[model samples]
Target: MKMTEVSFDIETVPSTIRYYLKNATFYDSSCSDNAKTVFVKGADGAFLKISKKGSLEREYRMSNFLSTHKVAPKVFAYESDLENDYLLSEAVSGEDGTSELYIENPNKLASVFGEYLSMLHSLPTEGCPYKNRTAEELNELTNKEASLNILTEINYSAIDDVIIHGDYCLPNIIMDNFSFKGFIDLGYGGIGDRHYDIYWGIWTLNYNLKTDNYKDIFLDAYGRSKIDRDGLTYFTQLIKLCD
Candidate 1:
């Protein structure tokens, strides 16, 4: 058996892929363009994710946290060097929501997305280490084009904190026949306002489906009788500013 090879985004390519390529498979693309992920189905199955060394710790921490709650993949091992990092974890056992099957069933997909998000947001946050505070978030904003005044101008109502999946998009969600499986790309997850995830969920649906016809369906499924239009606008602006 010969090892298979695949081109990854130029950041961190895995040397182990060459050794295991005969029995392993390579994923050239993922939701994140910044990192590289390769899937290997061995004794139990796993993903070998490679990325820059510094920030991979967050994903490792977050994955461990969620896995404890039975909400994410189980981490197998994590290792790193000065220039690159590696994360090996059990492969999520479901079809990605971005798959054509799910894409065709927008109503079912959106409903499941909303229900799973509700479950996620309901998790306890007392000891959770990650937080997406507004002040901290604003301070991290790097977009010179957006006004800093926008932050000051927005009057935030009392916040309700829950475990927010930072990048709650279609690709990150996994489903098996409309039943929720698990979440991937958890680097951005933390305790944050529900609106942040809501905004991204809506944005992702619109983006991936190439239409804005289903925001209400998702919101309804998420069971928000009182929509926080102001929070939505504010956080959307905040994310845009940061970008």
Candidate 2:
């Protein structure tokens, strides 16, 4: 959410997206350790993300898929060579959920956040390309330093499959005028467990607002009938271990 004005050599950008960056001012908008995101400021704004080669393939695919549902920005180009991957996408127009405007109204923000997440989960997933998220997380846990008994306590079968935002947090959910715009940072997104997204939704509210008072409000807006409180707790702990 903190974007600092900075300079970047456009020559380093992949030729496929270089045209978009020419003569544009650059801002260091990166938040993740895995990628560097430059916000290109101009009449036609865009975001240029750079990472190791092959690292952004899943993101590219998922972004394009989400665009079809009008819940994400359109991907302009995805190109990679032997050394690095580059993704250029049109910027979604809005301030993210972490903006002071939204933070000032915790009640409305929590309700809108939950409503949008429920809408995302309700999207049909007939042809989703990424469906092995649960398996992948379980695989990750296998290499973790957890005790065997603790690992056995995780009930993988209890997870409900739904298209998840993967890293669903306040900063990733964009909004304008208190209305939902779209989501960003979708590299881990795909058809996965809904609890993963739910867990982060709750976590982000607490992390950003510095309070847990909105948890019940969020769950209620998201429809508590669809939630399993015990499963949410279990998956939350399981995901923390994987992280």
- Write down the TM-score of every candidate: 0.85, 0.93
Taking every candidate in turn, the Cα RMSD to the unseen true structure, in Å, is: 4.4, 1.8
For candidate 1, what is the TM-score? Answer: 0.85
Question: How well is each residue in 24-96 modelled by candidate 1, as lDDT tens digits?
Answer: 5455444356786776655556777778886678888888899888999998777787787888788877787
Could you say which candidate leads in TM-score? 2
Q: Put down candidate 2 lDDT per residue, 183-243, tens digits, no spaces.
A: 8888999998888889999999999999999998999999999887667866777786776
Q: For this target, which candidate reaches the highest lDDT against the unseen true structure? A: 2
Candidate 2: regions farther than 4 A off: 143-148, 151-156
Worst 10 residues of 2 by lDDT: 147-156
lDDT of candidate 2 at residue 17, scale 0 to 100: 84
